[model samples]
Target: MRIAILAHEQFPDGAKTALGVLRYADDEVVAVLDRDRSGHRVTDFVSDVQDAPIVAGMGDLEDDVDALLIGIAPIGGGFEESWREDVRTALERGCDVVSGLHYFLSEDEEFVELAAENGCELRDVRRPPDDLSVSEGVAADVDAEVILTVGTDCSVGKMTATMKLARDARAAGYDAEVIPTGQTGIMIEGWGIPVDRVVSDFTAGAVEEMILECGDDHDYLFVEGQGSIVHPAYSGVTCGILHGAMPDRLVLCHDAGRQAIGGYESFSLPSIPTYVDLYERLAEPVRDAPVVAGALNTAGLAEPAAREAVDEFAASLDAPATDVIRFGTDEVLETLLSSNPNR
Candidate 1:
């Protein structure tokens, strides 16, 4: 099957390239088209057959070609006419198009119409699930726990959420401390919890070490994946941890930019958005545990536009609090952790 993979945005570039590399390695790459600035392939742009007659874009697919993988990144940035033309061209040529790009992946009216008109079957592969098991002897209780935040695109809030939740618990007069558990060290000033760089064979070992440390000081531990496991920003280590930890409560945090058109689907697997969605998509393969709460954040001081989007999401999903932690404030976080809602 001749497959034409397209990359028009940032997040998908990494994933697209990675996919191409894998396919080529496995001798399945018919051709690769990447518009983003990626340093993976030595050639600026190359075709599969070297110098044979090839189709230009999606408009010219060979008779034997069966599938076309259209990848688009950076959806919130709005769509350009050229991109619309590309989509039109791809569909007009009669190819099976699969995309996990956020913008074109949603069930939006326009995209739905486009898919129908083009006779194209759109399958979104944004969130691929994690296939790892939880570490043994880690599921004891949930109190004064340690939170692990590590990976490619580790959010400051992932660790900060620990602070906010822990603080809220403390205000309710519970014992909790926010600890930084990961292989890498972050610049968390006020989160006065201990820092332990767990050495492991891989990322999974690091997570196990963090949880083991948590067992000593805190009963319950919350570990945040650095990036999207499904998206391109995710790390193999993070997925390993998720599989190995089998955490009691899986709190999936969604960035406000998520609902945007090309949000999560734009990137490759392991991206932050894709990682979170992976948990949502693959139910049994990933984890059987129920998600305690789906946290939402604007990734900053909540601008008016961002605030509006997040508010609507929080209202819809019933998230208790949204981005409630200030940066580098141990006292504030301590207070929040002290108030345990589960208690």
Candidate 2:
């Protein structure tokens, strides 16, 4: 697939969709469609995208592009009316549209007619599957080491840490697979059921099914977690992720500077140790999943301060810790190796 990402006005937030696609999808990302950023490189905004021209309109898209990826995750994950013209143009050009939003472009008659008229496809990535049911909690039956990324709060690098550790484990000669649980992860990995989009009653089962499919023979199943278990509104999805993965080892993901949960004001964050205990208690029914390491997100802090924060965080937990994004996952992988360095 030759993809042209429709990022529009939302550079980083919209380009976030492109981030996963550029990393995991087997596609030639020809350009990113953000009008104001035209002529700039995608690397200018997302340093990891290698390089793709930021184009202003469909006229600027390369002639051979096969698809237009709606490459932004907005606040509510809803379809923005403002993106209509861009998507319409893409479809009119006979490029299939792939959307990860909660809104289904396939269900919209305009998009449906456009795709049909142009022989283009409309893919809705967040649509729940038809057969999902309550979780049987059968993931523990697998022989693999199920390791999950649990976070102190949402958007605290849970998915990134999970993917990072999986990459490290593979490089170290272990067979590890990261099981994605969210829309972005699904987009990256190509087959996960979006547990959050499923009916609340079936969310856990959706996750459990994903685990059983991927957890069979891998040395480690790095389950990408969703919302915080302590988050008031999003706790249900978090609980589903926790119970479905049924992990035997856990990695706690948090940011260096998040003193409290981002949106909620009433609660101050407990100490890292306390938060670790909280996760342990929830996972106790499945296994005594120790918080094997702390994965810190020290993205904006100075390099020296980030390193200091990593050292201090490890000291606080008396366990392995690293800014997995800024730094590498060697320390965290070493901690896992100490217990079982599988080949």
Q: Write the per-residue lDDT of candidate 1 for residues 105-150, one digit (tens) a residue.
A: 4354655676688676555443222332335534324233433332
Taken over the whole model, the C-alpha lDDT of each candidate is 0.43, 0.82
lDDT of 2 by residue, 124-218 (tens): 88887898988897887776788888898888888788877887788889999878887777767766778788899887788788778867777
What TM-score would you give candidate 2 relative to the actual structure?
A: 0.93
Candidate 2, residue 225: lDDT: 89
Question: lDDT of model 2 at residue 147?
Answer: 85
Off by over 4 Å in 2: 13-15, 337-343
The TM-score of candidate 1 is 0.42
